[model samples]
Target: MVVVKYLLKFLAVLLLFIEIDCDENDIESRVVDGQLVPIRRFPHVAFLRIVLPYGEENVCGGSIVNQFLLVTAAHCMDFVNLRRDSIWAYVGHENIDEINIIRSVKKKYIHEDYDPFLNTPISDIALLLLKEALPLHKTIQRILINIQFPSSKFVTEGYLAGWGLVDEVNETPTMWLRSITQELLDPRFCYRILNGRIPGTFCGGSKHANRPRPAMGDSGSGLISKHRELLGVMSVKSAKSPSVAFYTNVTSFYSWLVKTAQEALQSTCGHL
Candidate 1:
């Protein structure tokens, strides 16, 4: 009887460890139900590699705004240790392993007002200034940022591409780029679902059941409109529903982005 009791206790401890492991893995790779993107299709999509102090690496997606600037989520920069850590951007390749052009990040400009502790943080954007300017080519280019606000009458769908996890059950991120079409949701409906209003953010997701939705690792990936204009940055995914996610609206930060980019370029390149 005592032996059986001890065995049961051991099993319980083992099960607890397994649960913790699964949770960690889930948080690390959180993208699902996306289709593989064609090579050179998403030229402006950047695969960011952030190396922490102890050699630990974190991955986030970003959009190439110009030769020297790339934009991502401010939260993605929260844990970065600039004194010891490093960031690298890989562009012009659909496959993560294939390195066509690599640029090291020289500066980080996170939105000053961003607060991650908020129920829904606004201004979750950040810009990374590369040490060297990226060369434009057939498979490497910059995406145009949309300055006009999106409306239901004009914008119905947006495209999201990233190298995040394609299978949550297996806990693995795709080596190749993947993309999915998400239907934009009404702002009122999104506010209701989130239980609050996030002024500089908007919501989008798959209308059909079991369709792809942006997840954690996809944060900072661009939400591109049909006309190839960047509309949003992947921000937060709904905890209650996998089919719902929020994005930091690019249009809301257009002036800030442009002004910041101009200043940074002038300082780095001596001209804009």
Candidate 2:
């Protein structure tokens, strides 16, 4: 059964970003040294933090793609170890505690091919369906997903934001939202390391510093190219400095995203 299949494996990728208390100067984007991103700059970046029934906390990122949809990484769902009822999505606020509006996730659609055990997760994307539609105002809006493959000339410096752990040793998230600009590297090498390259996946990282790799929390964080086009969700990370950050390519799954998200919004709770 799908439920059982997901239940058996716990994701190790999220653990790779476990917070360590290294000097902030040594590791950047620990949420660590990234610049504070004001709420108004990219309000659509949703804080998808979760608190387990047992009291454990998890932080992941996502972006509002429609009135009722947000795209995130499937691993953020904790390989199905986490439940939709326990997960909450926050919008219109830079601080998680000060979120302006919150919604329950009515449903989640993970790519059917997601395999938690793979060295690198393929089809790591997931779409979260909000129980209620968001009110698209100036502070909060939708980021358009990229359906066409961005050409080499079109690729730009990518920017990513999230509320992931700031100190690698502390196990606590950053006090405020943070953003960093990263360079998109060729992903063909990542495909080799990941063992398999799932369609719609790419890679990115920074060359300026070497310490911690890039991670956008658990299930999802959006990566926007220099042109501000939605590239995909930040999925896996390597602990090595100047490491590659694997992302699920938005273009590879654009059609699936549209069909599933639109259908989920149109149907009632029980209808798949």
Residue-level lDDT tens digits of model 2 in 53-158: 6577677888887666788888777644444237788988887778869987877888888877766667888888777767777777777565476777867557
Q: Which ten-residue region of model 1 has the weakest summed lDDT?
A: 20-29
Considering every candidate listed, which one attains the maximal lDDT?
A: 1
Query: Model 1 over residues 154-199: C-alpha lDDT tens digits?
Result: 8898998998877766767778888888899888878887888888
Deviation in Å, model 2, residue 115 alpha carbon: 1.7
Q: Which candidate is the best by TM-score?
A: 1
Off by over 4 Å in 1: 1-30, 207-209
Give stretches of model 2 more than 4 Å off.
Answer: 1-30, 79-85, 191-198, 207-213, 216-219, 240-242, 268-272
TM-score of 2: 0.79
Whole-model alpha-carbon lDDT for candidate 2: 0.68
- Local distance difference test values of all predictions, in order: 0.79, 0.68
Each model's total of backbone clashes: 0, 12
Q: After superposition, how far is residue 134 of candidate 2 from its true place, in Å?
A: 1.1
